[model samples]
Target: MTRPNRPVSTVRLAGRPTQRSALRRATQIAMALSGFLLWVAWHRGLMRCDTHRAADRFAEVLQRLGTTFVKLGQHLSLRADILAPDAQEALASLQANVAPFPPEQAVQEVEAALGRPWQQVFARFDMHALAAASIAQIHRAALPDGTEVVVKIRRPGAAEQAETDMRILRRIVLVMQGLVPSLRRWGLAAIVDEVAANFRYEMDLSREAASVRRFADAWRGSADIVIPDVVDGLCTPTVMVQQFSHGAHLHGLPSSTAVAAAGKLVDSYVAQIFRDGFFHGDPHPGNVFVMDDGRICLHDFGIVGRVDGNMRRALVAFALAFVEQDAEWVVDAWLDLGLLGDGTDRAVFVPVVRALVADCAQRPLKDWSLSGALAQLVAAGRTQEVRLPRDLLVLTRTLLLLEGTVRLLAPEFSIIEAISRHTTTGVFDEPKSAASQRLPYELGNAAHALPSLLARRLHSVLRQGDLLQLSIKPDARMLSGIDRLGRRVALALVTLGLYIASSLLMQHGVGPRWGDMPVLALLGYALAIRFTFSIARSRG
Candidate 1:
């Protein structure tokens, strides 16, 4: 497959803006933002106010700012570590339903991308947009061979406009940092850079097409999922053509069908995160459709998340810690995952996260919410100066959107249950039963071989008459360090084994019952938590 040219750096300026034009744009943005801030202050200071209303007005201002700021708002919505819940909710509206440019401009973009007249490219191309967003708009079209497809066209001058906006934003961030030195700790510059990079990546439609292909390959043998096939040779940086999927939106499905489809949707996402380490970052209701046969169809691959191996392990550990309700383990896993900032106060951060997890764990299984707990944890991070990983933030955003979508389909559906089921089956990692069962046997074999090996070494030393002359001097601190390392490693292994066994017992419905969970499993979890606590203490 052909790939479009990838830019060396997304933040690179497309073309230098004239001094007058730059000044004018900057002045316009400053005036709009100042007005909005003043309105917010007046409304909150002098009249009845709520975050929701303020958030809505904030989103409106961003929408009015044009594509770059709209995209920024959508990006900001994903930062659970930065924005409050209401602000995130309001900013999410920027994801879709943006005003579109003229059809003539869309047509012009298609022609330019394809290097041919619009008439020569398709048998029928609808001038009307199927959907429109800040960066692009979609048009329903058919190839000369009668194959139905959708053409996604980038708005005219989107790249140049994004470049200019990003430059202004970067300068603004610098100015803010200079004025308020404390703001530098928040890494505003890094945030702006990330936004610019993401916008640039989305601008290249070819990358989105490639993402769709990868997802299709990942789910090739799955029966319950459908990824639209890309129209090869028709994809370009500005234009992407893929088979138009036919299905009802999730909201249109019956409750029964919606529940089943939601399960499959959850399963697919779990596999994407744990098995594939790649996931659809933006899975809002608009991008999800349920086919007549109940297969879930995903559209618009513009935003996707890629997790590395270490991050996947960290996430799996996090899930394990969550299920076990071991707050210390949760904090440890997060810290191990490098989610903490340099100046993070563990004394404060740990207690906040612990309280959040305990509250979530105390809820009834049917009422449990993974997304809510995660959101709270991220919000805590913001207050405690903990920096969540970018991939993690994206995952949180996916789960938040997924939860909303699932709730719309099946109000009583428990994401916690789905995640627990997958965890029990070892979809996120190695099978707990198999690993727990095999570990002891492997350790026994090693133990059985150690005596003979040690005896032989001693006999050799004696035969050489060097046994008495052999004097071993070990550093006290080194030995202490080794001992601590060994103890922690052993504790981790035992705790993991216990947790796995507990999950197995729960899965097979073994032992007595404790509110739907096996009693033995519950005990096992308790023991695992105790061991985790011991490990944490040892670290101190």
Candidate 2:
């Protein structure tokens, strides 16, 4: 997703002192710590939020932490399997309720981004903001052509503040890792990097406009969903203008109506992810609205995802493996996606995956908890030395979010069942026979990849044919062992020489009896080092 460079209204921040920012961060940390301490102090007492029906309190705390933390909470909210349902629902509210900047700042942002007066750009623009969030705020405007639209204005220094908060978050993650080694397998660092990368893209409004156009074009004829038309001339890096949308927020919609709408939405989103390999990465309820006619209008194309052909195939394989109850195939799919550790023992991993699948199958997905699944999966992965990739975790979050949103409409809907029905009907699978008939569809996808693949192949051919090549004659492994042994022997010899020199100097009364223990200690150390190395060498 892209953001605009110009904001509707600008509030030039007086270069706030570094101390001010530090103080703000310190204050946030102190508040967070205070909350944690209060929770701990009453964790087993009557006032514990976890024990009481007080999910709202936890959500309130997360929102108070500001953008980065709110985003993290939104991510956590996706894990319906792990978090209590009440808490997840509360956190979902943050998708739209996070703090907003002033409308004057938004107008200034639009003016600065467009490099012209707001009046010159839009025939009539409302100064009041329609909505505000951590990243940007929305305003209503009318174009010279008499078309009504909404403009999204990126907040001033939003990107810089997000980056700062992310750095602080990294430290928090590092501390968490130290306290919990199992976190290493989660690839939290990579997750943070991905979130940062996507958020950076979101900070650019132009990119969001382009992505919105892309989605609009891709789903042009789709009746179940709507992607707003981008107001090309009115868009900038700091601001984006799109066709005005009208719909009831998801929470306000009837459950049955929401379910039907959500089902189609899920189907469309899954198709985009699995079949088209391009997906809107963020699908929070706030980014989605249900029109009066039952069409789902997706907003904020700030975070999209793309999977390569190979990864798409692996995903298909994973689904197939799930259907077939093939543990080996599941493991293979995991490996295909680079979700396994180098030292992982296949023997142990295969059965673990099989057991996990069986356990998962025994329960309906609607009842699944992300945290519980992770705990089980992580426990198994550690025992089997499997390491799940960060992206897969995000993918898991994506699915959970989709499922949660779907449940908001239809509480009893079964994701696995839906997937099975689709797969079995060949809705997701394109048969070879169909490929022959649908050559255009196949070619369209191929055309996207052919250029890069051809270039890579040609470059590889040229490199092998003419590029300089150097060959080494030494046996690399053998040479490495020899080098290591030589270093150890040389160090031992030097130590002996030093010990002798020190002893002589002491004998000549140039030094005290410090030479006695020092020389003996050096010799003993050398002998111990040699003994340990020999033992390891012998074992090998």
TM-score of each: 0.72, 0.64
The numbered model that scores best in TM-score is 1
lDDT of 2 at 327: 77
lDDT of 1: 0.81
Poorest 10 consecutive residues by lDDT, candidate 2: 1-10
* Residues 1-540 of candidate 2: C-alpha lDDT, one tens digit per residue: 221121112223222227678568856855684576467558636554454334555656655666666776666555433455566666666643445666667777888888888999889888778987767888899998898899998878777776776776667667778887987866677667766776787788899899899889888878798888898787888899999988888786776886688678878866786776778877767778888888888887776767666677777887777666677887787567655556765565576776777787788665644333333444555554455554565566566667667777677876666666677555467534555868988788899999999999779978788546655688889898888878767666765665566556545645233534554444555665665566456443
- lDDT tens string, model 1, 231-321? 9989999999999888997776777898998899988898888888899988889889998888999987888998887778878887778
What TM-score does structure 2 among the candidates reach? 0.64
Query: Where in model 1 is the C-alpha error above 4 Å?
Result: 1-20, 36-57, 95-99, 430-540
Off by over 4 Å in 2: 1-17, 27-31, 34-63, 76-100, 169-198, 247-263, 290-295, 340-387, 410-418, 421-540
